[model samples]
Target: METRQCGPIGRPRGFDADEALERALLVFWEHGYEGASLSSLTTAMGISTTSMYAAFGNKEQLFRKALERYTEGPGAHLAEALREPTALAVATAILTGTVRSTTRPAHPHGCMGVQGALVASDSGREVRDLLVAWRDNSYSCVHERFRRAVDDGDLPQEADPGLLARYVTTLAFGIAVQAASGVGRDELQEMADAALRNWPLT
Candidate 1:
């Protein structure tokens, strides 16, 4: 019996894993999971098939890593926004931060998590679920923050925290799509500011 070879061919010639992942993330962000091929990923990452396999295991694993990078980088502001003392401040921060992140000129125009898989396919269920889970977790943070705000008199007692959370998150997802559609950062920021003006008062 003979042992079979697995993954790609040879060892990684040379490439910065972070940089490569960033490139791959952009490809995925722009084209989505199903649209992005291994060839596109390798070309953008400046690495060979074998190198990507050696470093990131497989396409799915590589996408997971890229998602991690996205959350830690562009999406990191959500953590701070959720910790805001007032619900109004929390909503403002989330919307404004979303505008900034989605419109960053250096990277792809939208958020990797939100815009990456808007139209999920049957085979991409796992990755799609992961994105949804991340979005839901972020929403929960907003809900918790608003609940605390209501208890502390920052938000009206009758206001629904879940609704508030969903509203702002919906705005965020919309902003991502608009940014990806070529909306300017200033335009998006203005839209975000207008949305915050609709924030419920105590």
Candidate 2:
């Protein structure tokens, strides 16, 4: 009698995929796309070269998966920020979350989405483009939320949701850059507080 298996039978992965990808995420977050070598990623992820490729396809694909993990896990506050009750609350959530995430000691300082591929090489244009698209989509989501706020009378009807969205996004990106440059969390939070204090309101 012959026994059969459901999936392709290969050597069982010696690493926990979620944990390895999280390690890879941190490596990419710290080093950026062009800067992170396969050696560095695989070493940090505790996987061999062949295993890394077999598990995640290639470096680019691995980066993409790690990035997805980042936004879904450590970076999930971005999506949650838009769920605040009022426009001011939403802005506050975003700004506050940005400072916290960017300046936290556990993860690398700054945003993986914003700084991950800021200066990629030509060969890394695809990776950079992916990051850019993710950021742009996030901005669009914020803008739509702000637009709904206006319709719901949370923000003034005359408020330009697009401009407002740009303002908040710009502030978050700047905070990320500063945090990456060793700025303290308190300083960035002060900035966020000040920005919300002067918010355009009804």
Candidate 3:
């Protein structure tokens, strides 16, 4: 007897894994993990149960991968904005950009992560923890940037970067909620601009 190669050949699924993950992510983003049933994932991912299990493990594991992709893909821009030269610009970009993205025609319902968290229950500990951690880390990153701005004399010496960072993060999340609640883009932009202007920069 001779050992034989298993499954389809020819570059080993050049279009399968990536497409499946993308589809699964879209489903999870659209509907929270609990809400996105197996049938939904399989239908959206275009993969059978066996294939999904073999490629992405169990449901929880697959959900984690989807969340990771979200953070690394669609959500990456917000992290990038934290690297702006000044705290004011970073805050402005984070808040205003978020408002624009959330209220855009393509994503008018608001942020996937924020919406998912709101629908989660106590049993959804992993998902809740992931969202909280992501938000906390965002604050930390922005706080460090604010600290750099203070050190560079861009912001007032007496300004507390830590508090400012938390405030900015809060404002961003609040704007996300407002967008979800039917607040228009102009109002959110004005709010963000006024918030940025109020930052102490003596």
Best by lDDT: 2
Worst 10 contiguous positions by lDDT, candidate 3: 7-16
- Per-residue lDDT of 135-201 in model 3, one digit per residue for the tens? 7888888888889998999988899999888888888889878887889999889988888786753
RMSD of 2: 2.2
User: Whole-model Cα lDDT per candidate?
Assistant: 0.87, 0.90, 0.79
Q: State the RMSD for candidate 3.
A: 3.9
For model 3, the stretches where C-alpha displacement exceeds 4 angstroms are 1-11
C-alpha displacement of 103 in model 2, angstroms?
A: 0.6
Report clash pairs, candidate 2.
Answer: none
- By lDDT rank, best first, the candidates go 2, 1, 3
For 145-166, candidate 2 gives per-residue lDDT tens digits of 9999989998888999999999
List candidate 1 stretches off by more than 4 Å.
Answer: 1-13
The TM-score measured for candidate 2 stands at 0.94
lDDT of 1 by residue, 1-202 (tens): 9999888786745778888999998899888887899999999999899889988999999989988888888788898888877889889999989999898887788888887776688988888888888888888989889989989998888999999898999999899889989999999898889877767833
TM-score of each: 0.88, 0.94, 0.83
**TM-score top scorer:** 2
